[model samples]
Target: MNYLHWLSPDVDLSGDKAKVPTSGASFVKYFQPSPPASDPPHRYTFLLYAQPADFKMPKLASPLAFDLVSFAKAAGIGEPKAGTFMQVQG
Candidate 1:
């Protein structure tokens, strides 16, 4: 099964990694289209991948700056199986 880390724009995952849930290598979150006042709508995207038989979470300095393609290659997740996005207005 694949393991996923759900991230939010305002929520910090650095100290709350333990609270994140694990699924079939995928963790999904609701899309919040609305940003704070004076801010622009953020693009929320989902990146799906095929998890390897044996997988482990790699140490990341900043999860927010994570590169999807690079992570997939390092984790042996292969290319994204599917993807989608939504826009929220501030």
Candidate 2:
């Protein structure tokens, strides 16, 4: 789901690879993945979106009961550039 949220406001995409020392970057929401114990495997999807230069990061109250679709719609980041998913067991 929405376990982790990391943002790099200004990343250096000049090179072939993205540099790590991004400007104004941080994890607004710390990583906290809690795969179910009973379920042998849990599916997780990750999406990459482009943010505007002036886009602002938001503080979340909690990961619980969070709606990612609504948030993405409000952010207006448009369609995701890339996406992938993985399965994990608790």
Candidate 3:
């Protein structure tokens, strides 16, 4: 899900390597994932992209409404260079 945003490119993944930092050099906390506790186990996938030097953050009504494709295009981020996933039981 496109729900987590990381504000700094210097994001620290040392705490939880499984969770990727969503924000980049231009924005912070654009979206975040929320797996309901009542739901069954779910697999969370993350796509890592290379942000362009001219990348810019897009305006949004809410982080929940953030769209991955649109955001990537707007921010000049190309297709994911790498990816990772983890399963969570909620």
What value does the lDDT take at residue 7 in candidate 1?
38
Q: TM per model?
A: 0.57, 0.66, 0.60
- Model 2 earns a TM-score of 0.66
Which numbered prediction scores highest in lDDT against the true structure?
A: 2
Worst 10 residues of 1 by lDDT: 1-10
Over 1-90, each residue of candidate 1 has an lDDT whose tens digit, in order, gives 122336322222348442334333323344334467787766677654555658665555554455766666666767766579766677
Clashing pairs in 1: 2-25, 3-25, 33-88
Candidate number achieving the greatest TM-score relative to the actual structure: 2
| Candidate lDDT (C-alpha), each | 0.52, 0.62, 0.60
Off by over 4 Å in 2: 1-12, 18-25
Cα distance off (Å), candidate 1, residue 47: 1.7
Residues 1-90, candidate 2, lDDT per residue (tens digit)? 445434444545579975555345464534545677887786677666777766665555665556677667766777877678888888
TM-score of 3: 0.60
Question: Which wins on TM-score, candidate 1 or candidate 3?
Answer: 3
Candidate 2: 10-residue stretch with minimal lDDT: 1-10
